[model samples]
Target: MITWLTIIGMGVITYAIRLAPIVLLERFALSPALRQALKFVPVAVLSAIILPELIMPGGGVDVSLANGRLLAGLLAIFVAWRTKNVLWTIVVGMVALWLL
Candidate 1:
């Protein structure tokens, strides 16, 4: 039927999308700037997601003691800056959240 045909067509399109990048990128190298930008993309993406959860979990931009997520995020930032350990950062953030 039409629905089955549409599903098969979508499968082919998805496969082509996945294969195209591997086939295309194999013949090229990223420039230095592009490579650096790619490295920062994950940080930028995570910050975008985490910042909202931390700063505005309740839809409004709250910055008070009731905003425990924001304070815990700040503590996590401090732990990351001081020790640069992912484990310690999580522990500190968890403790801060529990305390707050």
Candidate 2:
């Protein structure tokens, strides 16, 4: 019961925190420069989360050829760059990882 209550409380707090930003932003218009900068936020955040996992899949930095994740990520990057298709990138990356 205590754990459930704690989880519910945390969920409410997290929801409120995220909701406040959208509510406040809706009331005011952002600058052009700020809007442009915001477009890169998702990419930056994803890179921050994914790059480390790919480079260090075992919780330790491993940039050698033996690291399947690192190799797959590099191949994914190449696919994304060449094809510019998200679906293809994901498919190729997963297949590369599985085969490796």
TM-score of each: 0.68, 0.71
lDDT of 2 by residue, 1-100 (tens): 9999999999999898678768888765678998999899999999999999899999999999999999999999999999999999999999999999
- The reply for model 1, stretches above 4 Å from the true place, is 1-26
Q: For all the candidates, what are their Cα RMSDs to the real structure?
A: 5.5, 3.5
lDDT digits (tens) for residues 44-100 of candidate 1? 999899889898989999989899999999999999999989999999999999999
Q: lDDT of model 2 at residue 25?
A: 83
Clashes in model 1: which pairs? none
All models: lDDT? 0.92, 0.94
Which 10 consecutive positions of candidate 2 have the poorest summed lDDT? 21-30
User: Residue 31 deviation, candidate 2, in Å?
Assistant: 2.7
Task: Point out the worst 10-residue segment of candidate 1 by lDDT.
Answer: 21-30
Off by over 4 Å in 2: 1-26
